[model samples]
Target: MKLKTIIVEDEVLGQKALAGILKDFCPETIDLADITGTVSGAVESILKLKPQLVFLDIKLGPNTMGAFDILKSLPRIDFSIVFTTSSELPENILKALNKYGAKKYLLKPMDIDEVVDAVDCVIAECGHDGTLLNIDQIKNIVQEASQQHVTKKVSVPVKSGIEFYPIDEIIMLRSGLNNTYLFHTDGMTIKSSKNLKFFEKQIIPEGFIKVSRSYIINPTHVYKYSKEDGGTIFLTNGCTASLSGKYADVFFKMLNSST
Candidate 1:
């Protein structure tokens, strides 16, 4: 099915890059609707065209409000989103996007294979049944984004579905061979599809500290710290995680600053 799609990017080059990909690779699946750069123009075009999918960029020139403003101004979100972002974009914004129902994200400079994969997924997801946010949820997302709110919950994508964990309920996270394991206060460990670095980016602002490459611990659950055995973090859950020398200085600095 050819999806009526729009590209909402500030940079002329970004707009052309994705547009070129669609025109060249995905001509059968994507019907290029329109491209808008400014927040006002995006809002106007989206309202007029009513596209099924939108390729949205996080930054719009000097407008720090970014894509969230365009979303907020819209009447409703009936279309699915494929967020286009750079590596430099903050993780909190990434969290916000996921929190509000964005499932597809593409990092720039865009790869052809990844772009194609995202479009195929969008057609499948949006074609059958997909998550779309309402105006109220959009407002909350924008508010959090603007205020730079530290999230209280972390969403972990699992094999079955997404799992939501209260930040306080988490004891520590350990990196496994393929995925990350999350230890909670309930004595259950949930496995997340994302890596240690993914969780670190999302939860570090919420007081979860990466004590080692293998582990990230919630300081609120710290029972004690022992300098013995190289270094180790003792948690209230009666679990101990090894602290690596690599992150020891930063961890120590955090402890010192909190005092």
Candidate 2:
């Protein structure tokens, strides 16, 4: 099925470029529904047309009517979105976009092949009922993409300089009074002055799970889960961490989804 698509961009050149790319490369998969520059117009068009896909620009207009605002104003998000932006987005915004079921995040001066790939990925994953994507499917897609994007390394700030850790070598994180301790697979531990929340926002995208208020673990290194001991998780590196009952349900849910 051809996805009913809309472009919400203010720049004339950007609009032309994106539309041209879709026409040239993704003609069979996408049907251009409409194009609008403002958040209000985009929201109205989406509400009226109920298009299956949207190419949304971050800066629709002033502060009150940004792309995020349009999403927040909607009663329900039944359509998928591909965020088109010129600037590199902040981590918080990226997390929000992923949470809001964005199908893809495209940087401007867009590449035709990337556009085609995004369209193809969306088309291949959509439901047969003509619903392009639901929240769960989008979350899975975003999570997978995030894992791929963060596979190689993670940069951590240290007192002397920055330290880079191979993502696979990391075992888990333990929260401290005002800092967080990172345990590695190679019998090394590093303490960063940043809090658990900081590391959570940074590395959770890389498949780390917060099993409790003070512990975030790499499921890849999980040796065993001991339910008899109030849900203690033992790592492959002979380290143990407690999984709180309060967060157990969501932790298991995420674990199941990943598997």
Candidate 3:
């Protein structure tokens, strides 16, 4: 079933680009309900149409808070949101969007394939009926946006698209044949085409240590360390990873610093 969708972008070019993409590639999944630029216009159209999804821009005109204001004005947020913006979203705002039922954001200069994929994802999540988030949930999201806490996350590229995971939830990563396997706290393993080196750069800043050339481990998920067979570390998932002697000192130091 096609999702009843609205576009709330300020720029005329952005509106055309997204609308054209949707009309061209996402006709099967999206039913364009309304397109508006201002907060008041968006709110009005949203109320009148009761769309299942909205493509919102973070900055509306000179008001940086316009998009948020439209959300706050709503009686309840029962639909899904996909934010469209040029700048990297603040961590707090990202967290708020996630809480508000937005799993992804489209960067400006939106790609057609990506736009179609995004709409498909939202349709899968929203369904024809749409997911219902209460007013209190909306308020909490707004409150979170007002806060300054920056949650660190890792964006993993997959065949389907991108997956965002909290850094702390990753147990460890093991490299094999130019690909990387990510083990999560939930016992989920994601095999990515991205090489280990690619992920190393993304996670190292969050305290994940490269214990060996083939393995990177989040010390927080280290269940036990063993000196047997040179050195080895057991993860919470009971998977053991080699701990190269060269990195042992640095790894221990990192663990010490974290504690």
Leading candidate by lDDT: 3
For all predicted structures, in order, the TM-scores are 0.66, 0.50, 0.58
Worst 10 residues of 3 by lDDT: 123-132
Candidate 1 lDDT over residue span 112-194, tens digit each? 87689888887777756655677898888777766884546777879996677777899999999879999999899999887
TM-score result, candidate 2? 0.50
Better of 1 and 2 by lDDT: 1
Ranking by TM-score: 1, 3, 2
- For residues 139-215, write the lDDT of model 3, one tens digit per residue: 77787677766667777778896687888899999998978999998999998877787676567867788999999
Clashes of each: 0, 0, 0
Candidate 1, clashing residue pairs? none
CA shift of 236, model 3, Å? 36
Model 1: lDDT of residue 10: 86
What would the C-alpha RMSD of candidate 2 be, to one decimal place?
A: 16.1
- Could you arrange the candidates by lDDT from highest to lowest? 3, 1, 2
How high is the CA lDDT of each candidate model?
A: 0.82, 0.78, 0.83
